[model samples]
Target: MPRPLWTGAISFGLVTIPVKVVSATEDHSIHFRQVHLEDMGRVRTKKVCELDGQALSQDEIGKGYELSKEQTVPITDEELDQMPLPTAKAIEIVSFVDAESIDPIRISDSYYLATDGQVAAKPYTLLRKALERSDKVAIAKFAWHNRERLGLLRVREGAIVLHSMRWPDEIRSPESLAPRKVELDEGEIERAVQLTDTMALDTITGFRDAYRDALEKLLTAKSEGKELPEPAEGGEREQGQVLDLMAALNASVAAAKESRGEAGGGEATVHEMRPSKKATAQKTASRKKSTAQKTTAKKTAEVKKTTAGRKRTARKQSAS
Candidate 1:
């Protein structure tokens, strides 16, 4: 098993469950090093003191809290170590709340809380089962990495999962997101619902990241000194402006139905198809007319150029 980052007790009422916290997620993102283009040299960074104009050693560095623009309070390692915090060595359960009541936006990193020892196993299992039965999560506070953090404790797949949560004031209000509200029509809403239903998935098992796969393939080809493959096409979608909202929704529903192998039967589907087909034909005709106009303009410019050249030669001959 992987080593735990923290070891503490989950304090609830008179009961305490000794637990160890381990990070649940792994970093899978591809990382690159900054190198000089000329010689592929690795870059290095150094910390320098602005007041002294000298590079300082790690031991000389100290933490400071900014008081004002011209002042700062220098805090030492001894002072920070001696600072008092109630939840320093304990995960104190402050309250229990409905799982759904906690806003997901407030959640940050996740960790798994495992029993610290054989003696802690029973209490850990008990708390996990209780949380599962109540369908609620425990809101707790604990000090980790020198800072107190608010966290959520819940049962996931018979294991205790801890989620570090942001402070209540951290979430921003959504008022700035909306410029104005628009009215909705019942028929249009119904058609949108139909489209959503047709495209809905029962599970997330089929979800795939095509970009990640393609990147990995590209790296493999580069490393093997093989020919880089051309990108696969046909992913573009028609991004037409919605001139008629109802017609657009109806067409969307029809297309979704076709994808799901459903027959586009009924009078409503046929009516929807007619307006879209007419709009497409009109667009095509407009494009063709624009292309023809451009071609005619190009021919006219060529004819004018040729006539000017002939007139210039005749003038030269008359002058001679």
Candidate 2:
């Protein structure tokens, strides 16, 4: 059994269902060590007091808050405990709302919530089934590792899954993040929407992370003492956006139909691409074939020339 990252109770009015929070996501990216460039040796970092040029031991360090440019306030663990806050001991289910109504950007990490024992089984199962049937998600609050967080609780594969959600304040307004904006015309918008419909995947498994997979493979090969030759860099690819609403809707519908092997009445719109993927592949193969044929022909001609010259030399020698 996997160890729980946290243990708490789900509270609703007078109800409390004891549960354990186990991580649903796992990251397996390979990590590397930093080394000194001069001697190719492992590098170590040290923490030292900037003002006094003194290195403090781990036990000597204390937490401090910088109140102003020149002012500082220090506090101990006991003082931190006395800080005014609600008890960080429960997953309080506030209310349920449509899952689709929540913005995708607000989602943080995911974890599975398992019932602790007999007492918890009832409410846990009830909440899970209710959310699943209603197609709604519970917006709950929970305390994990001393910090209180807002979370979205939903049913996933017969278990209650909790997703830590970013607070509205924590998430930056999209407009502020990227200020640039471009308006699209009707035709362009329609075409882009059509393209999206054609590329839509339903089960998530339909899409694969090609770049990440390739990078992991590269790292693995290098780690195994087999360095990969640098890959040829392909220039930037084109991207699209929409401006016409109706046209885009029409295109999306058409694309959805075409994706289901229904590109019947019209020729499959060969995606307009610079050196389209198909054309690039064919060109590369043709170039290889042409190069091989040229090399073979050159060798054959060289042999013929050599043979003729030898025959003439023999005749000249015989006549002399």
Candidate 3:
């Protein structure tokens, strides 16, 4: 089992469930240290006082808030600990809300809340069951790292998980980042929807960090004094080429269907653009001209046939 990062109690109404907080995720990324190029000696950073130019130990460092260019106020851990924070020792559930109502962007780090002792088993199970049945998540407030933070509590895989959240004021408005008004036809919207549907999956468990895998391979080759592996071929798009929106969507849909081993003959076909007003008017004028020519040819043929019949009847009457 992993070591717990914190020990606290879940403050649910009048019930207190003692719990231990452990990280829900782990990093598998490879890290490197800075080193001198000539001797490969590790290069390390030293914390030094700016005024005296003296290197300091970790214990000598303390938190401080800057007031002005020449002024700063030093703060001690003891003073911060003694502050009036009700949620210091507990994960206080302020309210419960629908899980779907929470904005995903505001949530950050996640930790698993496990029962601290046998006495906590009953209340912990009760809270988990209540959350599961109601299908709601708990909004909470807790103090960590010398500051109070907004949190979200929800049950995941039969265990309570606390997700740290950004405060409402901490989230920046996205209005300035939005693009200016642009018009799109229904065909484009429908094609985009079709592409999304084609790319839909029930879960995203199959993906892996390709860059990390390549880095590991490169490191292994270098350490073993072997030839490095070359990158795979034919996986690049044409850079700087302007693409039609509808055409791109159609290609994406086709590619997605092909990846899933589905037939892309008919379903992924591109939409034909509608005729423009000028083209429609030209077609109308051409049809009218052709109709008038056909009418003139029919009238001339009838007149010729009528004159031939009149001459033949007159000759027959004169011969009689």
- Per-residue lDDT of 15-68 in model 2, one digit per residue for the tens? 788999899987766566899999989997777999998988889888888999
lDDT at 218, model 1:
90
Q: Give all TM-scores, in the order shown.
A: 0.78, 0.67, 0.81
lDDT, residue 85, model 1: 79
Q: Judging by lDDT, tell me the better candidate of 2 and 3.
A: 3
Ranking by TM-score: 3, 1, 2
Model 3 poorest 10 in a row by lDDT? 265-274
Q: Compare the candidates by lDDT and give the number of the best one.
A: 3
- Looking at model 1, how many pairs of residues clash? 0
Which digits, one per residue and each the tens of the lDDT, describe model 1 over residues 156-212? 888899999999988899998976888889998888898889889899888877777
Q: Order of all candidates by lDDT, from best down to worst?
A: 3, 1, 2
Clashes of each: 0, 0, 0
Residue 270 lDDT in candidate 2: 23
Candidate 1 RMSD computed on C-alpha atoms after optimal superposition onto the true structure: 7.4
